[model samples]
Target: MELDLLKEAFDRVAKKQKQSSSKTLDIVNQIEKEIEQAITKIQTTSNHTSVLTELKDKLNELAPMNQLDSNQKDINLALAKYTKLLEKCFQPDISRAYRNVDTDPHVLNEIISTHFYRQGLFDLGDCFTNEAREPNAASLKLPFVEMYQILESMRERDLEPALAWAAKNRGPLTQNGSTLELKLHQLQFVEILKKGNRDEALKYARTHLARFAATHKGSIQKLMACLLWAGRLDQSPYTEFTAQAQWEELAHELARQFCGLLGQSYESPLEVAISAGVQGLPTLLKLSTVMAGKKEEWQNMKQLPVALDLGREFQFHSVFVCPVLREPASEENPPMLLPCGHVLSKQSIVKLSKSSTRPFKCPYCPSEATISQCRQLHF
Candidate 1:
């Protein structure tokens, strides 16, 4: 609803701007036409002073200044309304939401350097690390450099590099249930068929795509059917195969697999953190404002006063809600695994054990255990 209002306000401003510009242009054109007529009359009548006076009189009579002022007023009013609407919709002072926390400068620099490398900004990464005196922080650049090279080749519609890399990592890729190799082969087969080479496409499919038939029967069948429409896929039912998005998705998948193999996330860590922070900012800002009087409590808080819904993408790990306490575990009250395989928050276990001085039975089972026997579980 807010977005709709903003869009409507923007439209009003745009409409008013266009109307004002048109009116101003019309007034200027009229003045120009009158001046041209005066110049022509002067050229014919040899009465320069009279022609000048007439042009001035005509321009004043048209009331161009008043017309322009009226148009400007409409646009200004629209702009003012739009500005107020924007200010109401967005909070500009994000600093109120900020909390001071100690961060390792080296770790922060490394993340920034890695983010730049992950983004394929090798020169910028190098420059940053050099300036920061953290050359080792750019160590992650080599793998990303190679990944970018393969992606660059893929962007040019040349899949040889990517195919070779996929072939080299075929075992690991297959172990991970990745069909990147098969997808790459499918793209190659399509490229062959697109060149009006049916025999080559068929032979390529038989050699490259046949191996996946046992597990990917449907996909293999689809690729085999695509051979029937060689050279003119656009006219065939397989026209979607020729879309540019296929290559884009393939590139993304390849990058994901590459990052997975490197024990890294597909998204930059800094990017993910920043995105999640942006999503949670409004809530944090509101909380901060409401707790303005309780600044010390806010500063001492180990967890946010309220839950921030950062969506599924930001949920990197499973959250354990203690059955006994009925609250999610936190760093101060982490989930503990009992011998009976039942998990409960440390706080709940302590309470049940009477501060570890006694044994307590598992809430879900007949098994009992002391707090000393329980192990802290990390997500």
Candidate 2:
């Protein structure tokens, strides 16, 4: 409903702007025509007074300046109405005290520097580190610098650096089950074949792609068929191998593999976390408003009041929910598993145990277990 109101207001503003432009353009064209006629009359006629009087009469009839003024008024009125609608639809800020997740300023600065380095902004990262007196920034920048250089080369269709990196990290890449090296060689082979170098492409494939034949036999067979078409690979049965988009895809895969080998993620963790938080902020702000009257109840909440369904992409780890309390388990209230395989929060265990003296019944099962038998589970 709010989006509809916003869209309606936006449409009104856009319509008003277009109308104002059209009206101004029409008036300006009319004024120009009138001025041109007045100039022509002055140039041709000996009676300047009569020509000037006729020009003044034409100007009065056109009323171009008045038309512009009326258009401006319409535009301003539309803008004012749109602005009023925006103000009505806007949600006020939900002010709340910060709780949970204490972060060190130094560690945060390091993370920011690492993010900048990962983005190929060495100068900016260096400046930030120097200004903040961050040590070990150079160590963090080195690996990313090499990765960016290889990525840039890949963007230009050069695969030498990436091939060399692959060769150096062959053991780890193979261990991780990454087909990046084979994919890079396949791209190179296709590039050669596209240039009508069939024999050269075959030799290149034998030297590089042949190694992966045992694992990727089907892929190798497809590439081998591309040899028949040679320069006409685009029209061949294996047209997917000749696509320009494959190079882009391979470059991204190489970057992912390179980062993975270096014990890093392709995207910065800080970036992912912030993106997920921003996506959930609207829901959080709405919850804050609804729970405004219950200050103490929510202010002390270790977990979120409502579950933010951020989809699978943002779900990086497992989260246990205590069935008894109907809340997500946090560090302060961790999930404890009984011998019978039922999980409940530590607080719930305490409540059901009757102060540790009696046995507690598992919510999901009929089995009873003492508090001492329950073990904490980690995500």
The lDDT of each candidate is 0.90, 0.85
TM-score, every prediction: 0.75, 0.76
lDDT by residue (1-379, candidate 2, tens digit) is 9889889878988998899999888888888888898889899989989988998998899887788888889889988988888777765453443345688888888899999998889999999999989877657999889999998998898999999999999998888888888888888899999998999999999999988899999999998988998888888888888677898888888878878877888889889988887787778766766777665456567777677898899877888878888888899999998999888999999998886768878878899999989999988
lDDT of 2: 0.85
Off by over 4 Å in 1: 1-8, 63-66, 104-149, 194-199, 202-248, 294-297, 321-342, 345-358, 363-379
Model 2: which ten-residue window has the lowest total lDDT?
Answer: 91-100
